[model samples]
Target: MGYEGEEIEGYYCLLIAILGNFDASEARFLYEYGPDHPVCQKILKKRPPPVNLAKMSKEEINQCMYRLFEEGYSKRSIADLFSCYPSTVNRRLTIGKKQDAEKKMEERRNQNNAQTDRCPEELCRGKP
Candidate 1:
């Protein structure tokens, strides 16, 4: 992986600078940095802690849920798309379904009220 330094076509390569020989999906590190590169070497020796979505804010969780639902994605697909745990996808789906149901109910109520109000004026007229 590269993390920082010289631009490769105007795009800074950070992974190439910071990370070396580490592939998460493949679960392996294939590069060996020089002894002078201490930061990359240390990162290799001690793996960094994984991000915990359970600690994320409600807004963040909602955003994930909406993306998954609106895009018609499966839990596993969403997990891979967002680089999160599959369990997180399952949890978000449940919450998203409830929220969607509530929204539909609210919309139905508003529509019904609008129709009733429109009918009242016509019903009041005797020369219909």
Candidate 2:
């Protein structure tokens, strides 16, 4: 059976998701020539979902946020992808930063304790 126009358009949307680039020129081309045109034939092919941002678990969301942040995506963009508010993203990022800082501080404290344990007499002698 042949695909209808709407089905073809849906395929184009899926293609856009796969390609991850739906610039103005591409939109104009698609609109001007329609999905059935020769240039759009490739787009008619189906592809799996690019990324299932929605319905992610808490751990997945944290990982996604960090990855996106590392990739230079703005908080707003990350929020949009996860279907949440920008403030939620911001708050999560803030909390993550705080936790990271605390972790580093704890590591440093442990290192200092180890050094002192290794040279208890030297440390007790103090600066001369």
Give candidates' CA RMSD values in order.
12.2, 9.1
lDDT of 2 by residue, 1-128 (tens): 35687678767766764465454456556666887998765433321224675677765667567666766677866676666899998877776666667878999999988876766677677832
Q: What TM-score do all the candidates reach, one by one? A: 0.44, 0.48
Output candidate 2 Cα RMSD.
9.1
Q: What lDDT does the true structure give each of the candidates?
A: 0.56, 0.65
Worst 10 residues of 2 by lDDT: 41-50
> Judged by TM-score, which candidate is best?
2
How many backbone collisions does model 1 have?
14
Candidate 1 residue 114 Cα shift, in angstroms, is 0.9
- Predicted candidate 1 versus true structure: per-residue lDDT over 21-126, tens digit per residue: 2343212222233334665555444433343576878756665567555755556545655577988777777787777778899999998887676756686783
Evaluated against the true structure, the overall lDDT of model 2 is 0.65
